[model samples]
Target chain A: MQKQKIIFISLFVLVIAYFGGSYLYKNWYTQNLDFMAKENTSVFIRPHSPIYGDANAKNYIIDFFDPACETCKAFHPFVESIMKKHPGKFKLVLRYAPFHTDSYYVVQMLEAAKFQGKYDETLNVLFKYQNRWASHHSPNISLIWAFLPEAGLDVEKLRDDMKKPEIDAIIKQDITDGKTLGVTKTPQFFVNGKPLIKFGYKELQELIESEL
Target chain B: MPPLQKTSNLAWNILFLCWLTATIATLGSLFFSEVMMFPPCIMCWYQRICMYPLVIIFFVALFPLDTKVVKYAQPFVFIGLFFAIYQNLLYYKILPESAQPCSQGVSCTSDYINWFGFLTIQMLSLIAFSIILILLLFFKRKAI
Candidate 1:
């Protein structure tokens, strides 16, 4: 009887300890991913990257996003809402990773929008009408052109700007940097240069609140 | 085995059902997390803490037909049920987003396997906990 009791107690404790330890380890490792600049930290931000929120904010959230990626669009407003809540405490810096099929053109249009100071508006328009234009099979780049009017840009000027070689180079730099930083998918976020290893909506808020 | 026959057959069956529920629930969770590669959220961990211990306790108690397993094992059942209910509510969106407890998208905020577009892993857990709780109560009332 005594031996059986001891065995049961041992088994119970062992099960709890093993799983509990694993859970704690995962959370601890992800939340403390501030080892900072495992690769070139310089690749995190570029001069061409669009900066949202206060330019002088100390907490820099470097986002690697795709125009056509569904989650990137869904979480855009959520990320914006978080930054809005904190007000000047954080800056959301955008880097383009045109991972989807034909997303390169949408990215080009966004970069070109920078020339007319309509980058943010153009991005909003693209995301708003993403379902109409973006698809994994073959994105309708022409449909995106129709929506550019919503962002109130000069169609001719935007067209001339989109063909610029510098914009293409900027996109290429972002893709290269994204690979270095281990951005395997769209909507990847880094808080204050620390990667968000957990990659959940709740986790995103937690990371931002922690930095704040 | 003679000692087991000394009790009512219904009690033995109820106890056996409880053990079976616990065992299946434990293995089911492992299958989801390990085999299916679905990540459990923080709420699942809390419920796991309650359920895992009962497997051992019930297993030990059954071999000797010890009725006192209820005193200790019942607590775990109740705790597991609580968390299971909370998780189901969050997963089904019955609870508000503000009440969400899982983080890193591994938990409540992210979608899990939605079998037939309705059932989910959390719902499976809820059913397991409920069955065990009902069997335990039945055993206590009629068998004990």
Candidate 2:
């Protein structure tokens, strides 16, 4: 009889915990969701921001990344996969957050590529060669220029474009925007103008899925 | 009452506590991932694999006050303890980031929640597992 009573009590406690935990987590989710969304204002998206997918797509995922960040480089493929998985349901908006000093140069190069319609290609090449050019402590920023030729980019034009004031302005504006949005790290994702309460690829995908 | 009966009663109490902690820990993990939408990393998944079964195991053992339940459940607690400790090491940066099994998306070193600057999801898991482990050890010592 005592054993049965203990078992009953144990089961009762477990049920209470399960329900109570769900309640507490739901409360945490909504509170943090609102706090996070407040910082992911539309101001984060500029008129000339680099983007992928249909412009008219109803859902947008804005990625704040640093070209030199290892985590950003690692997460790029997962982000791409998420977009591919959803098709026309989602669009990706790329914003540069040059957290590292060298990242500004890489962002400038990408912005310059926008003029030649090679923005996406250049961005891919940069990610591919990131280890060589974006490595910490001994980065070879010049190595990035070498890969441009193979991507069929006009090397001289890119160099000239990289020096343009407009490219500098774009990078500067993105930094200002990122700072306003409370982004202090690379690969920060905001889904449909809502910041991820937790940073993770699955979390980002699930958030997008929920919005969908 | 005989001393043996008294010790047996105390052992049952400790076992009950162990069961209770495991139940709460498992539910808490689910709540964070499902309701709160927090992504769990590879190490977190490993820890979950070790934790989730104890709820059923302990509940079965509880109905009969099976003393031998300790033999079955201790392995789970030990394995779970190993993972929880590893996760804490990674969380504290004592283990290098490159050593993390989370090669693809969510970083194992990522901090989802850090209460009071030191407490984290991994720390919570460690504490939970430690309590169950200590309770189980107490049960074994009493040999009820």
Error of 2 at A109 (Å): 10
The deviation in Å at residue B19 for candidate 2 is 0.9
Write down the lDDT of every candidate, Cα atoms only: 0.80, 0.80
> What TM-scores does chain A show, candidate by candidate in order?
0.81, 0.79
DockQ each candidate and list the results. Answer: 0.04, 0.31
The worst-scoring run of ten residues by lDDT in candidate 1 chain B lies at B101-110
CA error at residue A172 for candidate 2, angstroms: 12
Q: Write the per-residue lDDT of candidate 1 for residues B13-109, one digit (tens) a residue.
A: 6776787678768866885676334657788888889988888898878775777888999889899899889887776678887867554445464
True contacts kept of each: 0.00, 0.67
Tell me each candidate's i-RMS in Å: 6.8, 4.2
Q: Report RMSD (Å) for each prediction in the order shown.
A: 12.8, 8.2
Off by more than 4 A, model 1: A1-40, A135-138, B1-144
Per-candidate TM equals 0.52, 0.57
**Per-residue error (Å), model 1, residue B18:** 36
